[model samples]
Target chain A: MEGLNTVGLVEVLTLDGLDDVVRVLRDQGRKVIGPIVRDGVITHDEFDSVSELPHGWTEDQDGGRYRLVPTGTDEVFGFSSPSTSWKRYLYPERTLLIRARRDNGTVEVVQPQPDAPAVAFFGIRSCDLVALGILDRVFLDREATDPTYAARRSDVFIVAAACNRPGKTCFCASMDTGPTPRSGFDLSVRELHGDGRHEFLVEAGSERGTELLATIASRRATTADLDTAQALHGRAAASMGRRMDPQDPPLAALDPDHPRWDDVANRCLACGNCTMVCPTCFCNATEDSTNLTGTEAERWRVWDSCFSIDFSHLHGGSVRSTVKSRYRQWLLHKLVTWHDQFDVSGCVGCGRCITWCPVGIDLTAEITALATPQQSAGRKGVPS
Target chain B: MTPRMYEVVARRDDLPDTVTLTLAPVDEQCPTPAIGQFNMLWAFGIGEAPISLAGFENGHLIHTIRRVGAVTNSLAASTTGDQIGVRGPYGTGWDLTRAAGRDVLVVAGGLGLAPVRPIITELFANRSSYGRAVLLVGARTPDALLYRDELEQWRGRLDIEVEVTVDSATPSWRGDVGVVTRLVERAPIDPENTTAFVCGPEVMMRFAAVSVVDRGVPAAEVMLSLERNMHCAIGHCGHCQLGPEFICKDGPVVPWPRVKPLLRVAER
Candidate 1:
């Protein structure tokens, strides 16, 4: 508590002190959401106590696979990534825009009020923090802001957790997004376990974080603790299971008729799982519904994917009707055109699209395949 | 954003399936739309569709809609006094100032003609500001033509030239019968000073744009209005993306060079 007066002040806390951190946030009228074991997988949900956190649990994630395993050590905040990203909370799956009623001979329209609450996001990883910034660029920092996403994102507080144990599907080091929490959080915690000790190194990143840290019982962090945290982060960064060249090939230059697309299309189901789990894919469609009396109606915006045939529908028919075309759009939009649109790469190397893909379509492998030279003889009988 | 209320002042059947409606705001006035821009019209219990401004008459917005989907069908069924939700004057518009003191070539196919009606009207209103003006229109058949009376009236003018073409014709038809690109090939105009505005189906625009550029018109001087599935006309919805461009925000109207390569890619 003596070291909590300034930003960037490091403090040490016990496992019990971490529980008090959650208690203080809840006392300040913030809904606390963090990692919880639900449906046999680590996911995010609102919880009241630290006991709800997925302690001693980590996950094994590879292309097309995910399994939660207990590490036999009671180390909280040990998970690499959740099954879904924080976009589900900030940009919800569905939001109502307007409600209209037909009365007598005229129609009346009413704009729906946004349902937003002050939330404290606990255990958010560094890549997801970068994803939050990308979503902000798409929704808030634009010509016209999405009022619903703006309302939800305005009053949220972030408590980030450093990923000292990177997952097998993680490549955030290559994307330069994580392993250690660098910015965009009010408070950051690194779990230090081993040597018969279970403690956390907490740092204050904002004034509000300093005030909250002052209320809890903690001691100033020693140089040895800081060194241990740095060493662990360095080890995590060097041991990422996946790798991608940050300088990607210009995807637009690749031939649209490349045979690799056909090979991927044969395995791709267009099931849209990758879009749903992705933290930054922001396509949506509107749904209008009427009551039985036909007097009341509401328009709701729901999540949509480019892989769907109807995403490109026009007066005559769908534009990207073929599976090959849809897949190509998804790949090019994510890797190449996103820079033209947002001035940044759309992918943060979270690897959710690879793990969640039913057929294990690794994007990094696909990029390699597309970049490699192929023999012209193989293209003779390829289907368009 | 929520839509403002607009009441239908009048409706006319342009064809068996196409209806043109005159909409006037009930209270708050909607922003005036430029030639190539469009509005997201909401049919009370249905949904919204982006419809371009056909023209303006007296102060009301003229929208020519062909019944194709759920929202358009509901919009087409509305009577004179019915109220509907309307928003936007969204997307880029045709920059007429770019054509000052230049010959103008207008090419439209089928319902694509609706988006360019205002362009033709603006040209005639300031006839002295521009050089020779020609309009070429193409439809599937003789009976499918839009603005038949207006075309006849324009054909009578000696100051401007108007030509109509059909894919097929009956015995009584005497006009040109072929794809609209043929009109671009044989139109008597100096390509050095002509600015062309082309809009229609994607395939039609592709061919027409190529033909215009082939005739020595600069690709930068040729404009084409694009159509795509849109939800949030403000560009938050990602359905209208073509390559890196969001058709709803960056354009419904774009210069030819900007979209030529994108159009060449199948299903882009």
Candidate 2:
């Protein structure tokens, strides 16, 4: 393939020097956002300094629960992962497509105002990097190009941070999307605090990243730093708290009379919170509104979830009226049917769904409920 | 085609709860939609929903709409020559040419017959060229039957077989009293050389598919129109997704075997 531009790399700043990198990126007209400990969780936030980031913060999650606490080290980069993902950056909760105004007898549609500056997402995790790639496949496919997702994606530059600590809810190792990012990033960093010196193993994947790196001041990496980074990734890989069977069975492989879905649905609130935090969920609903003039009309698009009853509403009634049906659709689409439609699995196993759901519904547990039916007494002689 | 605002045309209480509206087309050709395609009809203030193309007798495209949703309720109450904007003819349509030499079995239930009527008209226009043509229709009541005038005209044809049944009947009625699938059982068909097309509610279509195939009609020879929520008439929006196929493009009209798996899945 013809290269857009040649790739280059430089070691200009330490891990703590990310503040200076953010400052430079901001001056270059990019929206810089990253993880910060807030409200007892590591969530996405705007930051301007190393102090603003979640320093030595780590998250613990079990089922539908998440908590953020300070790690016992002064090493600022100590964190497993954040609950809020990069999806909120690429696909916001809602966006306006048009706002209209009435002129004479005719209606004039006014396009939505220009977008904010392109973003340079900082401290992006490897699983999130894989998540972004998944979203790209869905939203940027030739048949259905989502302009809203595209606009946010194209302008953004990714700065992926290699994971040194794996979260308890994370199954990235099994999902093949974590511990280390293979591609789909501009720059990747491995922060190492060593004997009398703090350094980061920074690599540029793109020309823009190389140019930005050249502006920073730092020394070349010794063979030791490279080894350290590799070892850190290896440790993170082994430290993964969860694992899932990557066996991609067809969704039609599911037994209709399994009786597990109904049991799971009883606990599901249908709040759609799991989908909201998931980096790969891209279902949307379109809304049309008229201005006060009543003549001019505008159309807007917002994120929609399959969990909602209204999402399946037809002429007279909803196709899937019950919570069981909605939950089944979500699981089947994510694991099985989405592969049929998009030629890719809909999830990266980033653990957002497990942590953010109001009822800590573990996808792995649900899959286990189906995969090993004989293990559970609930499956015996029960109707779906 | 891009969506645009449109004024409503005349809407009258043509049948008890049904409204017959003449939609003003936004495009030049009045969007010469194929037989099984549908349009996303919308009222100005109310919401928009998919409605089948019932008839195109005049310059005004005729739509037999039931007063169901907010959009249709508002449309039912519209006046003469009122304006309504329409977008579509979206989704796959019937392959009329492919079924040319075979016996045609057109099975429809209630409002489902409205979308199938156009193809029946197209076939009748060239009546001599095709083989035996039969229309088996079913409705909840005789009053709920669509296109009474057209059904009468079809019943009088020498070459066509017309059979209609209702789930229940009135005291004055003297016709088949059973489910629509029962009419399919009674219709004389050369199953080996016949093509059956069904359009109705999901349950009705499923039952009809069984009835058609049980009579010896090949599963592949049966056609069905599947319904799903559609946001963008083009396939860009994911709302109308039915398995791997987009109901907006791949179908509304899909062969029985092709969509059989999706029929069993609840949320699709």
Candidate 3:
């Protein structure tokens, strides 16, 4: 592995050689988490062997639907994205912040140290990669860093997977975040298939990636292989199932009282599924609980959604009590207010929100409906 | 940030459900919060709530808490010598320097006066530095008024104009009985020269802010403190978000023009 100028070095590896990459990372005492078939659907989980990878399986994702389909071919990175992104690993659903115990008359407070382990994330999609960057800005690039998120995010080995077959709900191309890995990765893998030949084109994006690649048995890529990889990326980019207008006025500028909000509220469930599935939605609430004896207590940070009626609760009552207001807040926050807060759009065009919403409400379509003046004028006075 | 232990040294019942507890750090001194800044008061096994610094006495942090929720109920119920966790001095504070040579108009309703009490204290301490100063306070009823003694003392001072009003009055009550906005409407001031600070329930704030603006004060010159469901009190927790601003960090105090559009949007 020594003396290898790994950065930007592209190489071709067979299916067997691809398995060695996971072996090498595991040998280095890192937890390797990647896409796997779980409950007849693709989801991320920890695996020690490459055989656990969801080979020859693809996902069919559309508005309010998801299903796994088996492809009669050995394609390790066939799925577009799993049900969840790497967020569950980087920022767990729940974290213990502090614990306390009451002595004879005084209370003693103790802050619990964050539990973080070095992890290698395999087969990360490009849209989710951008989502990680967005999360970094939220948690790390601030005056006070979230200790739990910082600890887990500090030591991560990212292996990006370039998409070849974009999903039915994917719009990463319109978001300008996908089809091909751009940056912020240690290594990137592109699976190529055609003409009775199947292989993986792996490229070292960082020095560590190059060294790791040198440990595995692989041959340097030729010009023909590079051309084939570029063509596949081009095809993937053209095959996006949805598109958003880059010139669409910032959703913040849309009328807050637009009739379209009422229209969407009619079908909205206010279940907060979109926020849960979204890679960058970072709202959370803290809970304090005590033991039966009332002597020991713990404080925990749990993910919370703005859609909950209690999210905007003050002394008198909830500020946003109706489903219309909550749904408006979620949409406006993602497409409009997020840019003002984070200097980046919260929606990465991953379409997880569209696919997971129980009512099949597509934000892209909603944005268009809200942007159209005639549609709003035509729907005025329509009861929700 | 982890909360540091603070021992409640003194407690004063301001109202039936409200108490002002003066806390002294068990070991090191916690950072002194500026006027309008707040601290996350942790009630041992209850939880944490963002409480504004009502005042500071000698090195102790003073917080006036009203029992509105579980955490506040616990905090309000705490007696002297009870130890609680405290973390903060968070959020943007009132820039009193902006009011140095200007006429100051402070309008507070209900418990909102707690956050601006320090500002009022500073204005009285540095009386000659500012022009005409006026304070208008309102409560749901006469019994619900906070800082009753302090309001009486300020009313006696001839230099500052102090008006206290209640939504409903007892038969013996002689003070004004109306919303605080009525006082805002009739306050004696050069509209162009006055900087107004208003805080209260959201509806009260909106009406009071509009009244202040109607009195010809620039929207930017009118400052209001906001409240949201805050978990971390830092910007990381997204609960306190209001449009582009994080109420816990960017403000609990913000200029009116910046949040005017947001306030117009109901439930934003």
Candidate 4:
């Protein structure tokens, strides 16, 4: 901590050292939120003790399928991200934009400042962390900065978890987002289980993380420990169930009349589940609510999806009306058009949409459909 | 973080369901709007809508709004001296520099004439900067025509070619009758050197673009002001997304070929 580089300082952490890290985070007035196994899914939530982590449970995720399987591993983090992303925190589904009160002569418009809580993300997955980075570019780096996102993102600490065991729906390797996040983390923790011992190899990725790790780092990592940790991440990378075409641009340069769009549209419900769970999809619509008496009014920004008909609503009607058009918009927006706007693909390959989708429509397959010539008899059934 | 306070100084009924309101900034400084640029007008207790600058009479900012939805209804209903909020003279506008020595072709259909009003204002102010100018206007009916008196006065000018058409004309009407596209023959423009600007309903713009393009104007030389679902009049809100472009940020005014394929889309 005294004279260390602000980034990339790896250290060994024991079971007790993990507890110390959480304690230090909380002691600094930051609300520590981590993973907890509840009801059947491993979800990110507020937790104080490391004991709350899904200890021996790993998630099995296929297209339109998810299950909390008992992996029998005594490691803390054994699952990838759930349907919930850090977008819930950084960019809330519903955010208050403006508040107005009818004065004696005129309406006093009040654009309210956000109430940002000092919090630390305790167990952010590499995929979700990548999603946060994309959100940062959209909300912070854009022309009109979203004050709500800036407020929530400014003071929060990110303690990301390297994917030791990638979930069944994960394809971070294809997207080049993870099994290991490149940047935008205060600290990153990788879990390792070897010849009869379980331990964590934590790395301080920022100045604050370095300072915090000074108190919790049990020992500096030896060569053998580093190799074990690297192997674990390599295994997770190789084990992804889905593989998007990292070679071919996801949906770049698509023909407007591509038949693949029609095929996917037939299966797509247009329910907006993909956009809702997707880590990088950031389309939204604002709603205005007024209390009784019609004196005070408030405007709130709610998460809207490209799949929703009203997402592209104009003066007379919606811009994208048909399911085929809606799906086309979503796919093109995420894969191709997003590159033109943000200079990056919108999807992080987290696969929340793949698992959460009730119809089991996979972008990997859809993108492949666009590339491959249509077969005489198309492959049958959804990816479940 | 507060919206600039502005008061409506004057209101002119341009057509049925359409009014041109002139606004004067109160304590806030409003930037001079370029032709084809728009402002997000906020109605107290209601919401905001992006309306194009329709030129100014004196020093006030003018916006011609058609009562389409909620925000516009509030604006269209606003009386003179009523208070309203304003933000942005946002997005890139029509580059008059590109059309500097070239002929200028302005096409307007129905309320689309409102946004192009600024261009006409600019043309009249600097009559010699541009080459031959023509304004082709189309309306659903003779009664639906906007700024009828202004159109008559402008037509009197020997400098500009102003041809007006109606889809359905009355017996008393003496001018051209038929679609605005048909008037391309009447307003003989040197398409090679003419830069066309179109604003209207999507279908009208599409047909107008085709006719203008057929008249020897390149597709890229023809620009159209687009309408998309814009929430944040910046790039943040995804509502205004059109293919690779954000109608709010990248355009509102864009070259035809950039959005040509997208315009062919039924829903989007």
Whole-model lDDT, model 4: 0.82
Task: Please give the DockQ score of every candidate, comma-separated.
Answer: 0.60, 0.39, 0.56, 0.48
Per-residue alpha-carbon lDDT of model 3 for B203-228, expressed as tens digits? 79888998999999988899999999
Candidate 1 residues B1-268, lDDT tens each? Answer: 7999999999999999999999999888788777789999999879999999998767688999999999999999988999978898899998899999999999999999999999989998999999989999999998999998998999999988888999999898989999999999988778989999998988889889989988888889999999999998987889999998999989999999998878877787
Predicted complex 3: CAPRI docking category? medium
In angstroms, give how far residue A161 of model 3 lies from its true place. 0.4
Could you say which candidate leads in lDDT? 1
Q: Where does candidate 4 clash, by residue pair? A: A319-B267
DockQ of 4: 0.48
Where does candidate 4 stray beyond 4 Å? A1-7, A373-384, B57-59
After the best TM-score superposition of candidate 1, give how far the Cα of residue A113 lies from its true spot, in angstroms.
1.2
For A294-378, candidate 4 gives per-residue lDDT tens digits of 6787777888888888788788888778898899888888888878888888888899989999989988888877776543332
Estimate every model's Cα lDDT from 0 to 1: 0.88, 0.75, 0.87, 0.82
Tell me which of candidates 1 and 2 scores higher on TM-score.
1
TM-score of each: 0.96, 0.90, 0.96, 0.94
Off by over 4 Å in 3: A1-7, A374-384
lDDT of 1 at B26: 88
- Give, for candidate 4 chain A, the lowest lDDT window spanning 10 residues: A375-384
- On the 0 to 100 scale, the lDDT of residue B42 in model 2 is 56
Q: Could you give candidate 2's per-residue lDDT for residues B152-213 as a string of tens digits?
A: 78899888999989888999777788988888887877988899989988788988998899
Segments of candidate 2 deviating more than 4 angstroms: A1-12, A74-76, A100-116, A194-197, A248-252, A289-297, A374-384, B9-12, B26-32, B55-61, B233-246, B265-268
Worst window of 10 by summed lDDT in candidate 2 chain B: B1-10
